[model samples]
Target: MVSKAVVSTISLILVVGVALAVVAFVHHKNGTKSAGENLSPSMKAMIDICGMTDHQEICQKSLSPVAEKGSMDPKEFIKAAIQSTINELSKSMNFTDNLVKNVSSSARLIKMGLDDCKELLQFAVEDLQSSFSMVDDNDLRNMNDTEKDADLKNWLSAVISFQENCRDEFQDAPEYQSLMTKNLQDASLHTDNALAIVCNLGDILKYFGLEFNIKPSGGRRLLSEDGYPSWLSASDIKVLALQDNGRIRPNVVVAKDGSGQFKSIAAALATYPKNHRGRYVIYVKAGIYDEYIIVQRDQKHVFIYGDGARKTIVTGNKNYRNHKTQESASFSVLGNRFMAKSMGFRNTAGPEGHQAVALRVQSDRAIFYNCRMDGYQDTLYVQAYRQFFRNCVISGTVDFIFGDSATVIQNSLIIVRKPMDGQFNTVTAQGRARKNETRGLVIHNCRIVPEQELSPLRFKIQTYLGRPWKEYARTVIMETTLGDFINPAGYHVWNETSFALETCSYLEYANRGPGANTNRRVRWKGVRVINRREALKYTANYFIHAYYWLKGTGVPYLPTFR
Candidate 1:
């Protein structure tokens, strides 16, 4: 009864409905895309940005909502990456906090570890905020700065270190360790992704039509002919001049004999000026003061000196027997731009008191010139930031000179002390945990010798240049003299697993000594005998970007190899 046109229309409608149903079935079957379907522009862009990271899936997932906004700005991508890290870190911190709250007081070690994890997570958040601030403040679309890039990477690297250190506190609690690891996995992955993006920031900027200028090693010198950093302030120059002429005036003095304004170093530090500018000088007279000293975080631009390294001593005996390693420091400096000269920091806990720290330096751009750090184990904790040790003496037995800071020890003496019997010695344990971290120990033009007690026992007790302390541990020994006491193998593995051997970076360049021979060195993938060009990369100028801050301290350093 119906017309032919009506019948044709029904047929067309049915065919169209079938095609739509098939497309819907295919889309549901393949979560990403249907067969022969092209990806959305924003999704493609997200893949491209996250392709540089180790965790592409996490990166893409974290950035999916941001990508939906359809903005391709690299800065936006970086900001999102940092935000994702902050989110994950916050979650982990909450998880740790709950664990700490629920932990029983009877489980002292576990409780202590949880408390440490909570504190470390707080630090991680602070570091992430710092990184985010840098990205948020700068308009990367038009800026061609490298220092900012380096600073961002450094902060992110510290975040990773803090997370790892939190996990390390649980070495005695395996169940807690596994739980913490699971909790921190996403945070760690997010951090790694953020760091990778920062490491490749220049390339990313270039892709977005901006050139990130990374100055070459051969660029203009940072120092002027007057042997000062070009960026040194006029007031800093006057202070250094006065120091050189032996007419320097100190803001405060500490004398054990009650001759100065303060009788003790701790008392002197208590009077630090709030929101002060320029250098706050403290002179400690020649005497031994048995007290723990901490230069608190707000005390900036502090310069403390003593009569001489041997004459003035700050001594303590706290060790692993009773206190946490972090709390066992004779002197801990948390202030930025701190400088110490001609002073000795000691932990007289003896070898029996393992993991006693002589000096713990967390100050940024800190300088130790002609100072001595003495202890049996874990002597100098170069905990963080850029530190310079020039003409200094550091003595220890096991993992003595260990930390995660970007450190350079030039024209110094590294003494290997006799350890407790059945225990060997390791001079340095650079704790660089991630590949993108700008942290390492660069021993340049130094002498590594055995202490008076260890000299004879050197034959029986083995000593190594260093060992891999973390997955990406990095240490460079260049133009240094190593004693015959050092093991010919040059380095040691962290464990039988040797997991770090394939990831760490150990380089020896132009080192001359009986133990410096690379012929008998461990055949690790990361160990290398570098050439001159490679050696230049580890020098003061390039390694820590010392030009920006070192010269300002008035500490004599080799900007390049002599």
Candidate 2:
């Protein structure tokens, strides 16, 4: 795919030459050279408004033949051109403006920046389509005769110049590279339309024996509707709790000997199908159960909704001193399209070694809405693809919500129970496959508050938002309220050494609170401080597709963008 600049350059050279020839012919036919072509004040004003006055002299000279002799309505042609240019430019600006209005300092601004950049290109493509639609269809087929030759040349020159300016803006602007990346990879259909119109103008002039030679428009729409490299729509949502019937009946009720029916819950789970339609919902009764639960691989599209987070506790004591990392998990979900609502998943493992896991989810298209995860060190492992947690409470110490997945935690409360010395709250070890896997973590619109505040001498309580294990352990906070317990330096590297800084991509944006001091923020070489335009690209439309699919679930609060 050629850059828009290169195409503009080629088109410019072709159109400029044609304009000069038209001027020569007009002068020859009139048998005298007047002071430039007699351009209407309207045409001049249109040129001035579009910032194309620098080419006013060229337009006047080129339009001489058409002014003297042409059947086409020059005013109509110019109006079409002016309207096209304005529409395109306005659309591009709108996309960028919306991005800056939505993120906070604790938000992950870098990933947001990249996504905004992609959207900008999309707008540009849409603009191009509008530009193409403005070109008169009849003009494309008609050949310019002796009288219309100058008009043909002038119109072609102006259209080419308009396109050239678009090329110039994108090429010279440093930010344009990031924003234009995907479109450049494969120009979208709309962009192709604009390119086609620009190229066709030359052919229209050529039919009149003009000197212009426009290149072919070789654009193709890059993104596909089918779920491919990009996620198009939220598919596979699981609902565990239905509105009226088939609500998940977990068997943890009071039984014959003071012991609840923990085993019965497993038996009830056995009745669930290997894979159900759309989303899966499992409704659990309120109880204090000492049960270790597992949703096996075959139970696809399974969702578990409980009475309430505190009231419905799925707990087991798998402390570091007693169990291995694999065997220590209190609840493990290994099915696809799994979701849980209003449930509490806890592992009472002391903050010594990697022992407890409140919930381990290794499912694609999984979510935990209005739930709670409680533990110390590795509480909730967001262990797989496209996972989300909304309006949930996660309380822990030392890298509690850590994992290697493309997960999103939005509008949730992160409670640091015991702020450790030099320990950070979240450590995202995103195992983004080297140069391949586009995986990371996103924390948006969340609140970070601690149980108690400590003194500075007790070791700065260094609560970094994240540490990047892969080059892209991406984390962000948008519109989040942070308490004074949050450390000023928002992130920390693996070691004091700077080696990891080169690969890690930790960052924040627009956060507020006494703890959100920008002056003391960690100055990592890999991390970046981003603006709002960059953050909005990873919008709810892109991230939480399942929410749109399963919006009716009685989950009280979910992140929504109008």
Candidate 3:
């Protein structure tokens, strides 16, 4: 795929020429300049505003088209810029709508992807409209500095997030490579320019003898450079224990042959220690336990370990055809501080079974170590809060590792199995509804390989990195081995019509292996080449607050990539 920037450069040149023509006219209107002798008031204003922006060329081009039409007031130019941004967003939204129709009409393969696009694009439009309304509100209630600080800055930051979420929504789509990442990113940059200019409204007004006092809009820092979070403080990881042992003691034993305290794991859970500050360990003997298990929310700091992933398997077959994918999991863990090791969670529902989940975690600080999550689709749903998986084998056909949570999968094998006809394999389906929420999928130092069964079906290379189940979905694959089995485009995005592919944050950093070379990778602007500082934001150390939690869990993981 050709770089959009290169393709659009000719157009930008033409646009810039027209803008210069307008600048000449504005120069004369400002009552100065013999062609290019001296800069006028309007030209100075333009420079002043554009100078504060990151992308000066984009700012000038966007404002030039509007400023050429007789308006010289900085305030008016800011409004025009906002209106132009909203117009671009509407066009992008319409484009996505067309994509929904086109993809839906084509081979049924991309229907799900397009549907997700439509939903996310709709949200993007709403967010842009909301941002525009924020400007309108400023016009109505001449905001004090307090309102400007509290309201305007937050809204502008959200506007940036709006663009990002829109891009991320299609991060894993099929046509991800062909999408208009550059155009959408340009639009975002233009809006950011407007934001930068408008944020200085107080200073602008001060020149008119108005007492408009306000400070700079230092953006909302979602993640620190070090990834250290206030929520995952050191104190949060320590368990209240009566004993001084390094690990938790088993409260009950579960075995299939009635050799332990209970025959079923659920029965063993019945005797769970109450009000215990430390972990309650459940010793499960090696056996195939055919049951659907639910670890309720109250079972705090619970630990479950088996002999091995293959030797001690817990399997079920309930699927979305009979139960909700949100509920059809073989194992649902909702307890905070839950840790599982050397266990296998399987949902034996075949490709046709649809939406079967092996393990769905709705817990905080949940850790899975040396485990195997095997299923066809939606295998491991990290539903809510924070979770970590290390040295695990996660296998499935479609959307195997999914959900909306702050999740990190390190030193694991993420396999793409061949699915039922008409369904392509997508490794991750991130569901992040809100823009500001600290939720995303992190695939770090893992192996992205194809399932051997896929070779027989001739679908060993038709797999995607992920697709957005929500608009604000984010995922990063860092220091991982992406096998040659991956599709060259990397992702199978949601819709082909709009710039949905531009909104996703599907990133990679210093990955090695045949498929890790990014020369032919998706041209999606959101698929970025991040540095170590940016990559470490998704690492176990700072991203999941590993320093506070991993020590006690005994999970062998590097807290930081550095």
1-562 in candidate 2: lDDT tens per residue?
A: 4786896686578467445543543565647874445644433333332222233333333333333354244334343443444444455545445544543545443334434343334433443343344444334433222113222332222222222223222332356445544323222222222222333444434333454333345322223343121212243311222332444444234232335443344655776754444444445677766788888766776666677999888887785544434346788886766778788989876566554778887665677888999887778877544577888998776667765555778888987765445555643444332222224567677888765543342235556566664444566666677777666677766545554566666656676677556687777765676677776644454443433333444443344432
What is candidate 3's lDDT per residue for 46-141, written digit by digit as tens? 655666666677677667654456555555667666777777766666766676666645543344444544544454455456556766656422
Ranking by TM-score: 1, 3, 2
- Identify the runs in model 2 with alpha carbons over 4 angstroms from their true place: 1-264, 274-281, 319-326, 353-355, 419-435, 453-460, 497-499, 544-562
- Deviation (Å) of 168 in candidate 2: 49
CA lDDT, candidate 2, residue 543: 45
| TM-scores for every predicted model | 0.89, 0.53, 0.59
Which is the winner by TM-score between candidate 1 and candidate 3? 1
When superposed on Cα atoms, how far off is each prediction in RMSD? 9.0, 18.3, 12.4
Strongest candidate by TM-score: 1
Of 2 and 3, the candidate ahead on lDDT is 3
Residue 559, model 2: lDDT of: 43
Which of candidates 1 and 2 is the stronger one according to TM-score? 1
For all candidates in order, the CA lDDT equals 0.85, 0.53, 0.70
Q: Name the lDDT value of residue 446 in candidate 1.
A: 97
Better of 1 and 3 by lDDT: 1
